[model samples]
Target: MRPSGLRHHHRLETRAVTRFEPNLRIPGPTSLPPSVREAGGRQMINHRGPEFAAMLGRIQTGMRPYFGTQSEIAVLSCAGTGGLEAAVVNVLSPGDRVLGVSIGAFGDRFAKIAEVYGAAVDRVSAEWGHAARPDEVRERLRGGDYRAVLLTHNETSTGVMNPIPDLAAAIHQESPETLILVDSVSALGAVPFEMDGWGTDVVVTGSQKAWMAAPGLAMVAASERAWAAMEIAQMPRFYLDLRRHRESARSGETPWTPAIAVIYQVDEGLRLMAAEGAENVFARHEACAAATRAGLEGLGFELFADAANRSTTVTAAWIPDGVDWKAFNGEVKRRGVVLAGGQGKLAGKVFRVGHLGSVTVDEILGAIATLETVSVTAGRPVEVGAAVAAAQRAAIEAGIARVPVAAGA
Candidate 1:
């Protein structure tokens, strides 16, 4: 998908001063860096040409370190969900008993994919707003001989970041032979992830989240064990086949005609990300998330997720008791700040503010100011500027600047 326009220009608001641009503060399809946007609009090249190969090589090599893996990562022409499906189809055969460890919506989707493909899936679900605990998975694995264990590193729906490293360790301790598949679509780049260190067999992610690019591309990293599992897998697969992508990557190509523009976009985005350094990028996300949570709490809004397990990429908060949340989001949208309403059972109950990808401290503060305006206009109770002040204080305590350096400064 293409990016929504990101502008620094201002339009006077009669009701309240306009805070930011048309803020696309949704969970996915986050705002892209201007350079990535520029690169994506460039003329498409021959997918099979040497020029594409060299570009693909740069992207692949640059991406390996983000997931903390040296193994092969296959870039495909699909959304992040496709990467999850590829991981499923590549590892388990039909009728293979597997454990689906679910935290929220994405975890459930991963399980559904495995079941639809004929894997006998058993689910271990965590409470909504909480992460799947390692002890629970360990307890379940103790009793079952599953072929694989599915996990979501960060559950976007609930704004909970699972303890993957601890969970992976638990899985390894209990079932050494079982494959560990992770759907880290919204978490991998924006959050801390370790595929090799955590013993994750397969990890799936997308371009749209924290990669600072447009949608329509999925990146999948498979361990040697996952590749070994592909050899004996009998589940039906063609387009979502990891083997095809893996085999083609050796020649710096995809099995199908890929989204060449997105590849170019990710290459440029990764270049910018690498220049910033991964730790700094991750730290930036954490600081923004902290600021957001502090700001939201200061607005007298309760966060949806458990405080200890909140995600760094998105902060989901409950809509005030007397306000129409859907209308509130629309009001925020009207203020030129687009916030994400919740998914599944959470629809109209919670709102998400995306701080992933290319958002800045000043931009987040703008969104905060917009929320205050929307709250006041919608007649919901809020202390004017209290949230922004809390956020600014939190940022300072975190060693993050309250204001951001403007682009091209």
Candidate 2:
């Protein structure tokens, strides 16, 4: 007889038997790579010691290519939201006129941060599933003497990727002096962002998303113009102050104690990324996005984001009709594939699949297969293995290596 511990209780019959093989498919606090997870477990080091200093130096310098900037970056021991707050308070003063472009939930949060910091914010919004048009942003900037413009590179909530290069150009053409601050927490490593070439003044990202690490650190980079503005702009900052972080970074230290473990994970993640090469990293994300979208569509689910503006890191699809979101999600969870729910106004109507940071086509295929099984189990009509086949083909066409087959007798 099998051991009692291996047997399932009747009371928990419906629970997913995913004790050892759970797959994380959420937007962030993503599944870490094996090497990165190992790095996180190395014995803790002195935060003020030379070893910490060297690690700090490597992280800041290593992250430049991802941001596409030569500007100095400050690594703060906070979440991505904290990075947004730092961007707001460090660059604009109370009552300063600002323009905020919002396309989804994260966009709204970036704008809201500006408002809470006392900036007189004027919002330019797009439909939830669409990208903000450059012409619309230009029209808003016309004849307005704004101190700064807040932008989101990728709105994780609605699965939209804003055209930052085009939008930045429009802002500069209309108001050259206006500083451009971007929240790229979900875009930097997974997608390409050219900070210096695009004339962006400030950009921020977190460790959890594309960096393939656990969450805890936010990396921020600012241009010379932003630094000039920081010297005078005051919105009352201490712990979230970019100036203090930057100063401490010059000495390979943080003003406050850093999240040493997460930093270790990020450093190792960066090394892996560097080895893989940046362009390849972007291509892998593109392939994963293609696979996820194809799989969801093959299963008769409609995608939520507009066609041309879809995000490469996360894909949002409308929950199928007649299926209860909670029940469906629970079944999927039980099968070992954990997905993200719709956020804000989209709550209960959509499901998001995150495919960034060390996620592979094979893993995505497994998730697609799981979704197929769950859908069929819920009385939904799904063509058996159709979604998985579609995903495999899509991944191959998008430049990922084709899956290998076993030798037959």
Candidate 3:
């Protein structure tokens, strides 16, 4: 006769066990590549030691080409919000007037940050899921004694990519002395950001999103003009000080203890991206986004963003008639896919499908398949096989699917 514990073990072994599958979807803090994930498991080192300093040096050097700048790039041990704060506090004095463009949640946060610093913030607000027009921004700036204009390059909340270059041109023409600070958290690596070329003074981004690394680290690149303004700015700061970061980074160091694990991961991610080439990396994101949009359109879902300004990182789709968003999303979750939901007023009315960073065509197609099946099961009819075909067509037309491997590989 078997022991009672042995019988229980046998019974447990006979039952179907759930296995964890890695996430292949979601906008950011995207599935890290194996190399990047492995980098984090390395032995932790002293933040002030030469090993960590060397690591920071390499990261700063790697970030230059990606940011399209020769200006100083600072790594802060905080999230994207910290980068935003650094941008604001490092460059502006109390009672300075600012014009903030708000098209989504993140943009709203910029305005709030400005207000917190005692800056008189004037908002050029637009409906969520829409891009703020350059003319509107120009018109607002004309009315105020604005010291700087803050813009969100990609409003992740609404899947809208604002026309930053155009807005930059408009701001320069109207208020050349007014600094231009951009929150590029969702767009930086996935899209082109030419800081000097575009006349942008300060640009901030996070390690997640298009960088394809774990969250916690924030990167900010500031132009010479922005740094010049920092000289007279009276806003108080210590750890988030850009000047301190710049001074230390010159010798490959940080003011405070840095997140060594995240720094290692960022280094690996940047290495992978550099190997692929920056333009190629951006093109990959564009292809994924275009395919995603095409797939969604083919399925007959209405887009929340204007077609021209849709973000190349995430796509927001309106829940169709007769399909319950709750049930549809539930099915997606049940099938091991997670999607972002609408924010603020659009909550429950729209759902976001992220196609940024390391996502591939097959993975996106799988998501489309899941979405189509769930919509159909919930009584919404999507044209059979249409989404996948459209996505394929878009990918092929963009020449992204035909990317040539490097000679060695």
Name the best candidate (by lDDT).
Answer: 2
| Per-residue error (Å), model 3, residue 384 | 2.6
TM-score of each: 0.94, 0.94, 0.92
Give the 10-residue window scoring lowest on summed lDDT in candidate 2.
400-409
Q: List the residue pairs that clash in candidate 3.
A: none
- Stretches > 4 Å off in candidate 3: 1-19, 22-24, 402-409
lDDT of 2 by residue, 49-105 (tens): 899999999998999988999999999999999999999999999999999999999
Which digits, one per residue and each the tens of the lDDT, describe model 1 over residues 1-409?
3333322232233444465558778888988777788888999888888899899889889889888899988998999988888999988899999999888888999999999999999999999899888999999999788999999888999899999999999999999999999998998888777799989999999999988888999999999998998999998889988899888878878899999888888988888777777777777787888888888888889999998899988889887788777677777777788888888888888888888887777778888888887777767678888899999888667667322211321
Output the lDDT of residue 360, model 2: 78
Task: Report the CA-based lDDT of candidate 3 relative to the real structure.
Answer: 0.84
In terms of TM-score, how similar is model 3 to the real structure?
Answer: 0.92
What is the model-wide C-alpha lDDT for candidate 2?
A: 0.89
lDDT (0-100) at residue 248 of candidate 3?
Answer: 85
lDDT of each: 0.85, 0.89, 0.84
- By summed lDDT, the worst window of 10 consecutive residues in model 1 runs over 400-409
